[model samples]
Target: MMHHLGKVALPVYFWLFVTWLFLPLFVMAAMGFRDSNFVAFPIQSWTTDWYQSVLDDREILASLWVSLQVAVLSTILGLGIGTPMAFMVARFHGVWRAILITIIVMPAFIPIVVSAIALRMFIGNFGIQTGLVAIAFGHAVSSVPFVVVMLLTRLNSMSPNLADAARDLGADEFIIFFRVVLPYLSPALFGAFMFCMLLSFEDFTRSFFLGSFDPTFPVLLFARLRFGFDPGLAAISTLVLVATIALGIYAERFTRKRTAPAKQGRLAASGDDKNV
Candidate 1:
């Protein structure tokens, strides 16, 4: 009896949680279709004019362009920095490894507002003005910790024998890294690439503190919200949200597709070894 109740309760709980997570998104999507200027409940009519109008909003378009630039710059910087950090971390062990991890991931624990302010001050000390470069740097700083963690996780699961096998073939360290280690890390790198871009794109505090005349998408949205908003804002947000979701789905599938071939090769190699 208890088992049956537990089974029923689990499905109910899952559905409830899913609804809680996605209901707001559905409502927001619906809000975009609202015919009225002001956002409200019980839409008396529906229209797509708001969505059409957003395409003509120069300010919004500019902000989106700024956001795309920041995302690309931050992802590159994050991967460039974090990939080496992950390799370095993988070389350490015991207390030293723990200490290194703590220091590297310290930024993730810091409050965003505090970190943003600190970054702002730090950059100002070097006479770096708040703008695209500054915002991208800030985003990179935040993304590095997560990048290190993700890459390290993938690195840890890798068998050292692969590197050893390459070394036995007389490959130099750099050749082994590029040919063996890098290809092995492709899935993790791709995932990190997407993650860093998303982190930078969605970031508000860092962009706000680091921005100058040009603002990121989130910062611009916040500014617009202060005056008032129309269905057009919701329309734009829904479109962005849809795009983000689609990108995430694509990344996930791409990563899986990449890793599958590697996994199958590893399994086949293992089976041959066992047979021998």
Candidate 2:
């Protein structure tokens, strides 16, 4: 009875959670079509002029380009550094592993605002002035920890015998990782990449602190918000939300393609450990 009750309760809870989370966004998106300069409720009529203006704004375009550069640079850097770190943690076992785990998970607990301030000050002391490089580096530093932790979790859940079998078959570490292990991990890696990219793109504190001359989209948006509401910003928000959802759908499809093998491995592991 409890299990059945839980099954129904969870869906209801999730639906409510989603509704609450998205209601504001729906309202914001609706304001884009509001036939007025300011964003307000009871949106009357409909128009796409706000979206049209967003495309024409040179400042918005420039900031969007900068944001794209920073997000791409940060995701690349995070992926390069994080993949190895995750593998090391997942496969190795020692006292140092515990210490490394602590280090990787610590940054997630720290606020982005706090990290932004500390990183800016640290870079400044080293004569590294704020700019695209600084902003990208900061984003990578913040996101790498998330990639490491999440990837490590996924890797740990994977079957260990697959790696052992690959070794026994005379497969080198590189070949085994690329050919055998990577398929299982591609989903997690892509998810982490998306997380890092979105965070870097939406980041305001780090960009405000470190992006000296080339302000990012979020920074520019905040500046514009200081003056008053523009329905164009709502249009931009709607577009961003749509892009995010589209990326999520693509990732889900990409991951589903390779999930069968992971499931089979889980079944094999379950059979092998039947006594447990």
Candidate 3:
């Protein structure tokens, strides 16, 4: 009775939610194949020329390249800053840990538009003109909190005995970090790397505020939308959306694969420490 209804309702709700989320994306992808120059209703014909035209559009290509460079730069900066912050936070306990985490992740709670404006002001005061470097820095600022949280989750699960074992082997802090801590953190680090890149690439407000002459893909897309929509725009968007999804899937699989060996190595090291 109720159980049967619950079971039926659950699957129905799940599929409904999935459709609500992904149906638009599917529609956008379909729009790319439309043969007409304009984006509109039922496809009378289909062609790949829109996708090809995206390749020929130098402005689109240049903006995409800018987005890629910003992604890479911001991810590097986020990882570097977040790794040390995670380590520092891990050393604290109880209320102190809570306080530290609150301060570090506060940026994530701030409104994006406000944060972007504040960052722009901060950089301008230092005489840093808005451009590629400024955009990368702004992205990094937003990404750091997420990186810290991700790394901290992995860091908390780590066995302190592994570090102790390395120290017992006459390894210094630097050596232990490189040989033990870093290898253990590799999966989380890799996941963070991909996450920051994706975050920076898709971000609009921060990139928009931080950029000057050069625009990122999202900013450029927004600018073009004022003129009107076209099949070519849809084609480029569909391609980027698909690539992002594929990269996300790859990151998940790569993290899972790396997690197993990292755990095994940590256990083996712990055993060796006991024997010694």
Per-model RMSD to reference: 2.7, 3.3, 3.1
Clash count, candidate 3: 0
- The models' CA-based lDDT, in order, is 0.93, 0.85, 0.92
lDDT of 2 by residue, 1-276 (tens): 889778998889999999999999998888888889877778778998988888888988999899999999999999999999998887668988898888887877888789888999999888999999899999998899899987886787677788788899999999998987887787788889888988898888899988787799889888888998778999987887898788877877876666657667666764564422
Clashing pairs in 2: none
- Alpha-carbon error at 45 in model 1, in Å? 1.9
lDDT of 1 by residue, 1-276 (tens): 889878998899999999999999999899999998899999999999999999999999999999999999999999999999999999999999999999999999999999999999999999999999999999999999999999998787677778888999999999999999998999999999999999999999999998999999999999999999888999999999999999999999998898778776665544543322
Task: List runs of model 1 lying over 4 Å from the truth.
Answer: 267-276
lDDT of 3 by residue, 114-219 (tens): 9999999999888999989999999999999999999998887787898897899999999999999888898999999999999999999999988998999999
Candidate 3 TM-score to native? 0.94
- The Cα error of candidate 2 at residue 96, in Å, is 3.6
Q: How accurate locally is residue 31 in candidate 2, as Cα lDDT from 0 to 100?
A: 89
Better of 1 and 2 by lDDT: 1
- For candidate 3, the lDDT comes to 0.92
Q: How many backbone clashes does candidate 1 have?
A: 0
